[model samples]
Target: MNPTDAPFVPGVPAEHQPATGSAPGTPLALYFHHVHPDVRHYTALTPREFAEGMERVLAEFDPYRPDDLLAPSGPVRPDRPTVLVTFDDGYRDNLVHARPILRELGVRAVFFVCTGLLGQHSGQPREDYLTWDACDRLAEDGHLIAAHTRTHPHLDRLPPEQAQDEARASLADIAARYGPGPARLFAYPYGGIPAEPGLPGDVLAFGTVRSPAEPWHSAPQAIRRTYLPSGATGTWDGLVRHWRAQWQPAGATARPDDRDDLRGERP
Candidate 1:
């Protein structure tokens, strides 16, 4: 079936429409980190507004965690488009304003949190970050809790040893707080870190800035994401356009004969 003609999957939302003119095998993914009534002004959404947005999302897309949706999980399917929702910074607005909406929609997401920022003054008035109890509640609700490092530092700028420490310690803290299971996901601060050579085995997925060309071929750890802004042009239609543009071919599709050459010894 043509990419555009593919029927929308049940439980997946419409705002995640595939790119116009895309063919089968084209890779596509959608991402969102924050959702507020007005992001230009960095304000939280009112309960009613949040409810409306969730209702819209629930009608169209399957919200997934990075590991389950991305990675060496095989080639992309045009009809079965997968959208992953992620929230960075573990803000209280997530627990206060976003969680209820997500729960209402029955969509699960991953929250990348800075453990060090947890019980400290938020610098912003009104308890901006999520409390430990709130984080626990989110996890209990089936949302994945992942790391954004301990202090939200720029790991790329840090000394190599310090960077390693940050990565390890942050994962440790997240495991401790959320219970000792495998910790698989991570998000870099400000999208600054490169994929390291020897990350801990527990880490499964990491996030990076979205690149349209080669959208799905980044470092195994570097999953790409599009930022969702809130505004007049930032309506649900705007979100669909942004995702569609990213689905455009980064380069010519591989010819069937080239598959062997591309595989080489990688497999």
Candidate 2:
């Protein structure tokens, strides 16, 4: 049988459910970064490993297109559960291994890139990062390409002016190369955020910490994310354990209608 057709085990709830009498539409968002099979070592995968990982994800959640979440005027569905897949650091492994699997599964995801790091020769031990041409292809294939800062700087540690520069410069770089502008979506390097009091309002920032039970919080432009690491036991019991530990409240049903708002909210 195909791995994609494997049965999924339901995980425990990851967030807080609404009060019994409360109205529906409570938001719940789950975010994922890299999706490799073997993360014990940061090595690129052979084609077979990538295929297995893609099968695991498709069996679990509904992957969404970046544009669908950023659309300005659409009747957002409030009941569907949304899982946003994101790749950090412009890894070439994403284009080589992850992209093809995603295409086979018909999943759409977002790729957060560091412009200065692309096309540069890196001695980082892993040739898993993406190339400029690969990035262009992913974008052309309808995947969302957003900013991860100019050089992957930790925004929280920088001075106010420097933080703003990092944020703006990354955005500008993406716009110059990819087209009009990165949709309001932005991911902070090392999951960092600005401490500056007057940060720009144009972009939306997504953080690294996230859960499944509650919807993400709104900001001038900020959203929280759940990290799905590689090597997580892909069993039904394992998934349930992760979900319950991460987001689900006791005795609560997740409403599908709430998922629309959850996805649209920043991050």
Question: Looking at model 2, which ten-residue stretch has the lowest summed lDDT?
Answer: 15-24
Model 2 ranges off by over 4 Å: 1-54, 73-78, 123-128, 197-199, 210-214, 234-237, 240-267
Q: What digit string (tens of lDDT, one per residue) describes model 1 on residues 1-267?
A: 222343332333354322231222233333444454444232234456556644554444445443343234332233333355677777777776788777877777788888888765555534367777888898888887888888878877887788778877878888777654425567777666644524664344444443222333334355555433333223555344444433443553534432221111233
The TM-scores of all predictions, comma-separated, are 0.67, 0.70
Q: Highest TM-score among the candidates is held by which one?
A: 2
Candidate 2 residue lDDT tens string, 29-88: 334444444444322334565456445544544555667555453214434333466777
Could you say which candidate leads in lDDT?
Answer: 2
Cα error, candidate 2, residue 99 (Å): 0.8
Q: Give candidate 1 regions above 4 Å deviation.
A: 1-60, 65-79, 121-127, 179-182, 195-198, 208-218, 241-267
**Local distance difference test scores for all models:** 0.54, 0.55
Clashing residue pairs in candidate 1 (N, C-alpha, C atoms within 3 angstroms): 12-60, 12-61, 13-60, 13-61, 14-60, 184-204
